[model samples]
Target: MSADVIADFWPYVMIVVAGWLATDIWRWLGVLAAGRMREDSELLVFVRAIATALVAGVISKLILFPSGALEATPMGLRIAAAATGFVAFLILRQQVILGVIAAEFVLIGGWLLIGA
Candidate 1:
């Protein structure tokens, strides 16, 4: 390739490499560190709790203050779907996949019911 052609691609190449390094550096360090940590360690327990809380908070924010299409749906439908999912989660012994599927089913059914 000509020097001009290589120069034209250099910025894109650098952007991709920088983005990868930015995200993967921490993941690489985590993998290295994880091997030395016990599953039931206090740090692990706290990390799990924080992760769960963050997930819950994000879901709550989505339901309570949704954007675009979700905002078009009634709040009651959203709440009902969440409640059904919560029940399914408990009934299925905290099976996350099943609970998410149940919630989606409820939300989609509600959308169809309301002619959306």
Candidate 2:
């Protein structure tokens, strides 16, 4: 390609490459550091528990404090949507994709009703 095209693409390409590498780099570093430890090491187990709990708390907060388009919908509808999504996850044997789709469907349906 021409120098001009290369110049235009370099920043975008670097951003994508950097983003792709970031997660694996950290994960690999963590694995290397922890691999020497015993399977049931208290520190490792505690680290995993803390990480899982932190992620769960963030997820719960998002669902509870939804903003923008989701804010337009009623709390009852939002609650029902979350409940339905959880039910879908359980019914589908924890298939996350189906649960997300069901939840989105509920949100959109609520949005439409509220607008009308």
Candidate 3:
């Protein structure tokens, strides 16, 4: 291929290769080992708990000690958004996407309302 063509496609090629290298190998390994794993296994339970804790920790950090644009918003607004999202999550049959949407709506709405 010509140099111009390679230059145009290099970023796209790198993105595809990088994405595959980052996630697909682990996914394939998981699929291969899934048949041998039990849902109720202690290892699975521990993994689930660790994953949940990590998510919670991230959420806590974002709410309590935000950075950049988020830091501009008040702590009360942040807490309110998180609470609204959790309530939405529980009320909407645990649909995570809906909860996230609700949270974003609250955060953006509050930010706009207060002219922050």
Candidate 4:
């Protein structure tokens, strides 16, 4: 390839290699270990609980102390959106994607209605 083509493509190649190195090793390890893990294992349960808690903490942080465009929205609207989403999630048989869609719809709708 020409020097210009190499220069243009080198960054993307580096990004792909870095990303794979950063995540794929752990993924491979997990795949190798999953077959040996029991569904009722304490370690698996603990890992699941920790993962759930981490997700909850992140979601709570985003809702309570948001930055960027979300920071511009009112606190009540944010709470309402979250509550509506939770209700939708329950009503929709715990579909996470539906819950997220419901939350976004409420958030955007409220923002539009309040002209904020």
Alpha carbon deviation, residue 15, candidate 2 (Å): 14
Candidate 2, 1-116: lDDT as tens digits: 99999999998888777876766887888889887788788988888898899898987777778878666667788878888998999999999999989998997888788883
Which candidate gets the maximum TM-score versus the true structure? 4
**Compared with the true structure, what per-residue lDDT tens digits does model 3 show for residues 1-116?**
99999999999888888886778987787688667678889988887888799899997997989988788899999999999998999999999999999999999999999996
What's the best-to-worst order under TM-score? 4, 3, 2, 1
Q: In what order do the candidates fall by lDDT, top score first?
A: 4, 1, 3, 2
Compute each candidate's TM-score over C-alphas.
0.57, 0.60, 0.60, 0.63
lDDT of each: 0.91, 0.84, 0.89, 0.92
lDDT of 4 by residue, 28-66 (tens): 987887777898999899879987998999989999899
TM-score of 2: 0.60
Residue 78, model 3, lDDT: 92
Can you list the residue pairs that collide in candidate 1? none
lDDT of 1 by residue, 1-116 (tens): 99999999999888878887878997898788778789979999987898899899998989988998899899999999998998999999999998999999999999999997
The TM-score that candidate 1 achieves is 0.57
